[model samples]
Target: MLKHGLDPADRRRPDRLSDRELADRHQAMQGFLTVAGPQLDQLYNLVGLSGCNVLLTDAHGIVLDQRVSDGDAQQFRDWGLWQGADWSEAAQGTNGIGTCLAEGRALTIHRDEHFHTRNTAMSCMDAPIWGPDGRLLAALDVSSARADQTERYNRLISAQVASTARAIEAVFFRSSFPGARIVVASDDPSEQAMLLAVDRDDLAIGATRAARRALGLEREGAIRPRPAADLLGRQDDLHGFDRGERAAVIRALARAEGNVSQAARALGIGRATLYRRMARLGIGDEPARLSHD
Candidate 1:
């Protein structure tokens, strides 16, 4: 359960925060306030004109920064929206930030969908930000008037919030874990494998467990960080070598049931590479057995 307060509808209002609670939170957030600059601007621009109230919050749900169009900003602030406000369920009731943290999932809450009394007039979408180590770092939210929102709009807003959160996470990962090799994979499984910083010796790292499995690593323990050479098989045929570019290609082929062209596109590789790899790996031109059926 989330430690923050419950949704407004779930229970009666608790007494306001004690002085100590306020002081502790303020002290805990000094570092974040200092470093938040261009990223905030970027987020503002990303969602500024979308008729939504965008908010950045700490892991614990304290509102760190907010960006709404000039027209909406004043209204939102007048409604008690501002820095230092806590939107966690404990503070503002069952809303995007609190529920996302509680469930650890991207969420969409339309007006009246929120579990808190004060939030009934707003629709919100939120995504939880995760650090490279998979820690919950923060939550990004886009809230707006419920009258004009739809499921599709909610999805688009949530996607934007997720993207922004990921960008921030990437920056955070690069700065805090300078020596750690970082690999950013698309949430989409079919895209060609994009590998970053593969040459850094100290940052040597391998794909995630899922990526290793996709690459057909026989043993679980064999998936540790190693030279890129160790992972790629022979490079005799250009086509074959190209298909072997990344594990994502192999996974796409399997998922597509051996549809070469489809797999190639999903892996973000040329069709020729798929064919070449098929030949090199001894995979037949004809679809695999399952596809044949």
Candidate 2:
């Protein structure tokens, strides 16, 4: 705080963005906000009745949206926890929102853990949210100034805050690749939301941060396109079956005279499943015309 020239005893509120600047920032994050808005509301619904307020902030710690009860709005506003408030570590010292963004992690700052004396009455639990491209995107925070709030209760809220952040990241990732198929890269609950986006040709198009880390992709940038089967290390029968499955599919298609539905019936598989198998085996729509009937 000393290096930042902040006095721990200072009672002045943190600086805020002007209406014009705030509007511009909001516009910049409009897409993410649109996707994450429902998750934010769900989080608020979970904790709002407990005398807590839920806030979502951009990577710079400027509050983008907040949910607070009508009765406690003035108290939270007076404490500089409203929209447009600047809570970057340089501005607010070691508070939850600022510190979570600074450290890129989930944590709790309870009561006097606040750097500013006036903010000591509030307790905050926060988690850092990652964008679809694996960069720092935003922070999700739950805060309370209730006199009866306990550290134990804050810990519980902290867990929910972290979970909600991951949910937002998952929703944003899926929305980012509207045409791609999302595959769960990991079944571990700890790796919940570890997902990969694969195109129609089974080429990996994108990955969530956890998926990127799990699959050895670059940690902080766009992932290069690669074969999803290669990344997943699955035994795709295209080459692995040594032409057996491919030959069988070819024979079936030839027998059906290029009608995919008829071929699927001969192969005893669903038409969509046959199409997927054909795609996996590099089969084209123009099947061999072995027979007119």
Candidate 3:
């Protein structure tokens, strides 16, 4: 704050967004709220059973939504965990929401880890929520009053919050492309894995940040990242569709039961386009056989 001309000693006086600013933030995050609201409510109910309150904040760290067990609601509010409060690192110093936004990942800020002295009475765990296009939309946090049990609870809640964040990403991805094929690329069906949206042109249209990282989809530009592909050998198409496109085609076909029309529809491409891509990629007469081979 020294650089910003604000005093760190003035931490007691909280800052908040104005009505116009709040409204703009709300409008900016409307779509994310629509998908996250109901699911977060369910999560709050479950997590609240453990005496923790749940909060959702925008990318800017303004608490957009909060849910707490009635008995603990006042306690949480007293700690400044209510909606519309600006908890960005600039405003509140180090905190779960603020720190997570700064770090861009899952985190748990225990007592004394908080920069402001007043907020040291609580422990917080948070994870970033990403949008369909792989941008950060918000963060989900769980906070509990600090006590002897804090260390144990922080570890448990951190993992749960991170899992919930991934579920939120799944919702955003599926809602963004209702017609595209949703493929779980990981071999383990029960584990949280990379979910890919295969587009009509036999290419990947969307992938969660986790999937992108797992597949090594390096950032090509700010607006969009590149596709993930298994490294192919000599059979790989050079001038036409590459390994990435081939993998997407195989996965889509496998899920669609080898029906060219169904696979084409799932990829959001026409039957002719699917055939053309397959032909150009040097796929032989038995394209369905390619998936098994």
Candidate 4:
């Protein structure tokens, strides 16, 4: 709070961006808003009955979209939780949306945890959303002013906020890599979403933040394409001539539909040589299904 130059006693309401300025900001984040809109609505439907409001903010902490019940809308607006509001830590002090963006993690700031005394009446749960390019994209937040909202309840809501943030990131990633195959980098459910986008040729063209970090990739910026099999530690054709030959044989066999003679012909090799290669490659003999043609 001291570094942010915020006074705990400061009770002035946070200022909102001018309508025109807010419109420009929205225009900048139009693509992200489109991808995140449905997720925000779902989050609201999940928690709205409990007097909570869902908010999606750009990286700078400007609320670009929100879902609030009509009955609670007025109160949220008065508290500066509406769209166009600036909740960056610099502007609003230590709060859920701002602090989450500041720390790049999920957190809950219950009553009295707020840097400003005026904000203590509200409880906030927030998570940072990472872009497909592995950069901070936005923040997902749920806030409630219900007197009965407890710390335990806030924890549950924060879990949902984090999950929704990851969902938005995944959707944004898929949208960014249209026509590419998405592969999960790890089977561990505990880690952040680790995903890779592979082109039709089996080269990985993109990766999520967790995937990039786990793979020692450049955190942000253009990702150099790499063989998906190589990255996944699989038997890659790029590894050696034997693997390349194996891949060629497998592809030819698939195309020939178990016809060994046809597969050998396609590989420009005799059936005997094809059998020898297959034996060395550990491929199962399918002679029973092999057609002379």
lDDT of 1 at 57: 76
Clash list (residue pairs), candidate 4 = none
**3 or 4, which is superior by lDDT?**
4
Q: In model 2, which residue pairs have backbone atoms overlapping below 3 Å?
A: none
Q: Judge candidate 2 at residue 243 and give its lDDT.
A: 49
lDDT of 1 by residue, 1-293 (tens): 24553445544432334567756765775554444446667767866776778777777776766777878877677555556666676566667887888787788877877766666777778887654344566778878874767788778778777766655655554554456555544446432222222433422353433334444543333234554544544344334345445344555767887777778777777888767766666665653342421
Using TM-score as the yardstick, the better of models 2 and 4 is 4
List model 3 lDDT by residue over 157-257, tens digit each.
78888888888878877888788777776777654536777665535667777666766654321224233233111244453447667767777887877
TM-score of 4: 0.85
Comparing 1 with 2 on lDDT, the higher-scoring candidate is 2
In model 1, the worst 10-residue window by lDDT is 190-199
The parts of candidate 2 lying over 4 Å away from their true place are 236-293
Full-model lDDT for every candidate: 0.61, 0.88, 0.76, 0.89
Tell me how candidate 1 scores on lDDT: 0.61
C-alpha TM-scores of all predictions: 0.58, 0.83, 0.74, 0.85
After superposing candidate 3 on the true structure, give the runs of residues whose Cα lies further than 4 Å from its correct spot: 1-13, 190-193, 218-293
